[model samples]
Target: MEEMSVKTGVFGGTFNPIHIGHLVLANYLCEYGGLDEIWFLVSPQNPFKQNIELLDDNIRLEMVQAAISGYPRFQASDFEFNLPRPSYTVDTLNRLAEAYPEREFTLIIGADNWAAFDRWKSPEEIIRKHAVIVYPRPGYDIQTDVLPPRVKVVNTPLLEISSTFIRQAISEGKDIRYFLHPEVYRIIAEKKLYQK
Candidate 1:
């Protein structure tokens, strides 16, 4: 008898501060996307965005850990941290494939990103190598009919909340209690994160 293979989704993001919206989407994907697990790849650096006001990598990683602690199927990975700067999704996916041959990795992205898919590093290769699951984003229309066979468009409830919004709210000393997990919010408050 052979061991069962795992189907995992690679959800890469800055996760400057993991929030309720992120948790909700991940949980939904696990159910609808038919994934065995969802790995939150906390990028130490994102090439597309400037590093201005970015919190420390370890702190960001810790927040993700705190947010997803109780979920058995959700994992926080520091895989990109060990890699070189300007983490690209394709490179991360490639490394994961090599590291865990038994696991089939799917890329979880927002519909907004799908519109800019061609601009990514070797987008064609990424599509050819693994599955891409795109979730709904407010104001971004997803046309799965135009996407590749491996790409799927799922209609997850649009959670318009964003990390940027939460960060800005925190810096302004505004209440963001309802936007984030209790543990994550507590950690941010205790560490005084996002407050210059």
Candidate 2:
């Protein structure tokens, strides 16, 4: 008999600092969903959000790397950085599928993102091509009825934290030590990021 292949989870995000919330969702998906490994696909630039004050791609990648360092199953990927600007999910998925033929790719996204799925580039194609694992976010409710066939909504704990809130706190000179990894927090403070 041929060896069975393991399913891989693709968790894409800006990962400004890659807080505990992100880690928790990834861990829950990997453990409960039987995912082989979770890759954190760091976006160089998020088209939906303005990037005038966003951190450098390498800096965000470094933070994600530091946050997920010890986890063997968690990987920080810079695939989007290498791809063209304004990276679209469909394009990324196509490239990834072509690059890794043996691995199965599942799209991991928050329920809030799912709510705005129609706004994404080639949203229909994305749903048709890969499995979507939607995790709960604070204010967004999961509407599985509206999703396509391949999407699976996971009832994971909703984390109240967000990178936007963290950035705001940092800009206001408030401590966000509890929201991020110690090393990441230290790096942000030392680098004086988000402070105008």
Candidate 3:
């Protein structure tokens, strides 16, 4: 008998503080996208964004671990931390292939990113290396007809919640506890995070 291959979804983001929206979306993606597991790749650095006021890398990674701790199909990855500065998605995917040769990888992204795919570092190379599954993002247009053979769009829900909003709310002295996982909120409260 042949060995069964595992299909892992690579959902990369700077989860400064993993929240309810991220949790709900990953659950929906796991069920709807036919994924065996979803790895939340916590990037310590994003080339596209300013890192000002961003939480420490380890703290952000810890929040991710706490958020997905109870979910069997969910994982928190600090793989990007080992990569070079300004780690791009393509870099992580390539490194993943080298590190986890047995597991097949799928790149999960948002429709907004799909719209700006061409601007990424070697977008075509990424498509050639792994399957790309894009979930809907509010107000972003994804033209399904022109998608590549390996590129797919799944029916994941739109969770408008964002880490930025939660952080800003906390800074302004609002109790945005409902927007995050209980443990995540607890961790933030204990650390006095984002109190500005």
Candidate 4:
């Protein structure tokens, strides 16, 4: 019998400092999204978020590595690093499909991103080529009726945390123990990341 390809979820993000909210969402997606594994596709540069200050790719990657260390189902992928600049989701998915033929990839995105999905590069191709799992964001509302057949909305725990919030807290000398995994927090503190 031929081996079955694994159903993987492509959880892409900047992960400036991987925190508890990211972990929680990834975990929930793995369980509820019926994904065999969740790969964290760390973006070197996001076109839509270009104005926001970003940390070095290596530093952010290391923190993500530390954050997902113990989770067997979680993986950190630097796939975008080898690709062209201005990392786009469609391009990443296409490359991943060619590179890992044994794994089926699904794009994991927030409700907010889904709202603006049509604006993304090759949005139609993305929907036609792969599946997308949409998770809720505090302010954004997802309209499932208008989405493509491959798109799905799943109920996950509301994690009211953001990397921006954590970075600001660090700058203000506020405690962020509850916001990030201990290992991830340690890396940020040791490196004095986001300190003003």
lDDT of 2 at 3: 69
Model 1 poorest ten-residue lDDT run = 45-54
lDDT of each: 0.90, 0.87, 0.90, 0.89
- Model 1 C-alpha lDDT per residue in residues 32-119, reported as the tens digit of each score: 8789999999988655676887888899999999999999999999999988777778888999999999999999999889989999
Model 3 reaches what TM-score against the true structure?
0.96
Point out where model 3 deviates above 4 Å. 46-50
* Candidates in descending TM-score order: 3, 1, 4, 2
Q: Give the runs in model 4 whose Cα sits over 4 Å from its true position.
A: 46-52
Error of 1 at 127 (Å): 1.0
Worst 10 residues of 4 by lDDT: 44-53
Candidate 2's C-alpha runs over 4 A off are 46-50
Report clash pairs, candidate 3.
Answer: none
TM per candidate comes to: 0.95, 0.91, 0.96, 0.94
Model 1: lDDT of residue 116: 94
Assess candidate 1 and give its lDDT.
0.90
Which pairs clash (backbone N, Cα, C closer than 3 Å) in model 4? none
**Which stretches of model 1 miss by more than 4 angstroms?**
46-50
